[model samples]
Target: MIAANNLSVNRGGRLILDQVSFQAKKGRMLGILGANGSGKTTLLKTVTGFYPYQAGSIEIDGKPLATLKPKERAQRMAVLSQDEHVSFDVPVYEAVALGRYAHQQGLFAVKGKTDDDIIRKAMEETGISDMAERSLLSLSGGEKQRVWLARALAQQPDSLLLDEPTNHLDLARQVALMEHLTKLLASRQLTVVCILHDINLASLYCDDVLLLKNGKVICQGETQSILTRGVLENIYGTAFHEWKEPVKGRKQFSVVTRV
Candidate 1:
């Protein structure tokens, strides 16, 4: 499990995070939801040790985040960034194999049979095996997203942290990615902590959610229970109406517009 206790970060005379606390448990998808500027991305980055926190602590499976070595951390957590616009001049298989870098002895280490198998398995899991010999630039947006996801999965990390993984995808691609995540959660014991902007998407995909407003947590708990219309309005400072989505019976939002 990944836990953050009283986490806080200050920057340029402003507090980006204020005593944020939440747990992303094993075999669950925890969606971090908030309005823009609510510090959702900052919190994810801090957990990855990319951004420094001024106060509080982050723990992975009861071990302090600060104590883990770089390779150790990489082995435990794999992050997929929203802006992962890679221009790497390599085949899909080679790009996915890059996820195994931490396991290699040095920069010149070659892929062993096990590494190749893992890489191929990851691509197959993400449904990108056919693109193995293809270049990243040749794939479409949705295909590239799967390649990136395959790359992250090849890390074989127990925890996956995604920063708006659906950012540049079309509607169908978004559903496809989220649907695959749901299947992965059910099939494995992996933990997912995703930062999502779409309220309906979070409601549809997240098992639980953490709501934030102005760098402070509004609430965090089961998605269906905590994501009521009133709660969403309070967090976003706007009027909203709730309705059940016909397909899955999940709650969806329709913002009340004053025109």
Candidate 2:
């Protein structure tokens, strides 16, 4: 499990996060929801040790996140960021194989059968096996997102962090990615913490939700409890309507806008 207690961060003499606290349990999907500049991305980066906290602590599976070595941390957790860029024209397969770097023995370590199998399966799972030979620069935005996801999956970590993964995806692809994540959560017992702008998607896929406003946590709990119309409206500064899906009986909602 990933847990943060009284976490705080500052940048440019300005507070970006303030005494934030939450736990992402094993075998559950935790959705971080907020409007832009609410510190959603900052929190995720702090958890991954990319940013230093001014106060409090972050722990993964009872171990202090800061104490872990870089390779050890990579082995335990994988991150897929919002903007993934490939500087040079590299084959899709090669880019995906980069996830295995933590597991490699040395700079010149030979790829083994286990590594090859994992890479292959990751590509196949992301529906990019056929594009293995294609250049990363040649793929569309959505395809690149999938490839990045596949790379993270190849890490085979106990926990995964995603930052606005559905940003460039079309409607169908967005749903498909969420469905795939749901399956992976159940089958692999993966602990996931994702920054998502789509409240409806979070409602459908998240086991827990954390709502943030101005770098502070406004609410955090089960999806059904924390994603109510009032809470969403307060955080997003917009109106919302909540209802259950007739067939699935899942709670779903939409923003009400004035035209």
Candidate 3:
């Protein structure tokens, strides 16, 4: 399990996160929801040890995050950030291979058979196998996102962290990515914590959610409970209405009025 206990973060003397606490259980998807600048990305970075925190602790499977070595931590959890700026002109397959750096021996080391197998599995898992030979610069935004996801999957970690994984995706790509993620987590028993702006998507796919407002955790619980219209309104500062889908009867929340 990945957990944060009384976590806090500050940037340039300004507080970005305040005593945020939550637990992402094994074999479950935890959605982090909030309006822009609510510290959603800040929290993810803190959990990954990318940013320094002013207070509290992050624990992964009972081990304190700060105590783990870089490679050790990467082996345990993989992160896919929203602003993954890959300026290189490498092939898609080669970009995904970079995810295995921690597991590799030297800079000139050739990929072993196990590495190739895992890369192939990750590519197929993310539906990017056919794009393996394409250059990263040549693919569309959605395809690049899939390549990044495949890289993280190639890490073979127990936990996955994604920041806006659906950003810039078309409707079909978004659904495909979410569905693929759902199946991957369930079948592989991988713990997931994702930062999602789409509340409806979060409610549809996540097992639990953590809502944030102004850097503080406002609510945390099962998707159906925490994703209510009232809570969403409070968090987004907008009036919302809940409705059941005509075809599936699944609940969906939509903002209708400014608050």
Candidate 4:
């Protein structure tokens, strides 16, 4: 489990994240929701050790984040950034194999049998096995996005920190990605903390949600309880209509849609 208590951050003499706190448990998906500049990204960055904070503490599986070495940290949690620009072209398989770096010793690390097997499994899980031979630069945005996810999976992490994992996918693929995540969560072994813009998607796939406004957490809890009309309106500063989704019975909010 990953938990942050009373976390605070400052940049350029201005506070970007204020005493924000939340927890993501194993086998559960936590969605971070907010308007622009609401510290949504900042919170994730701080937890990932990308940004330094002034107060509070971060714990991963009962170990403080500061106590773990960089490699130890990467071995436990993998990140799939939204902007993964492949500067140099490489084959998909090779890209995914890079996730094993944390477990490798020595500067000239070669792929072992176990690493190769894990890489292939990750590619297969993400449905990108067929493109293993293809160059990263040759694939489309959606395909590259899947490749990155496969790389993260190859880490065999207990937790995933994703930033807009569905940004490049089409309507159908977006739903497919979320469905795949749900399937992975079924194992009750992985934790997902995703930053998402689509409310309906979060409502359908995430078990818990965190709503942020002006660097503070407006509300954080089960998706059903935290996505009420009043809470959403207060976060986005706009009117929204809330209703149960037809098939799954999850709550969904829209600014202009009706039940």
lDDT of all the models against the reference?
0.91, 0.93, 0.91, 0.91
Error of 1 at 137 (Å): 3.2
Clashing pairs in 1: none
Q: Considering lDDT, which of the candidate structures 2 and 3 is the better prediction for this target?
A: 2
Q: Which number leads on lDDT?
A: 2
lDDT of 1 by residue, 87-122 (tens): 667899998998999788977998999999999999
| lDDT per residue (tens digit) for residues 120-230 in model 4 | 999998899999999999999999999999999899888999999998999898999998888887774799999999999999999999999999988899998778888
Q: Encode model 3's per-residue lDDT on 1-259: one tens digit a residue.
A: 9999999999989999999999999889999999999999999999998999989999999999989999999999999998998777999999999888768776687789999999999999888999889989998888898899999999989999999999989888888888888998889899999999998788778999999999999999888777788888899888889997676556798779644
Candidate 2: pairs in clash: none
Report residue 81 deviation for candidate 1 (angstroms): 0.8
RMSD to native, candidate 3: 1.6
The candidate maximizing TM-score is: 2
What TM-score does each of the candidates earn? 0.94, 0.98, 0.96, 0.96
Compared with the true structure, model 1 gives a TM-score of: 0.94
Which scores higher on lDDT, 2 or 4? 2
- lDDT minimum window of 10 residues, candidate 2: 246-255
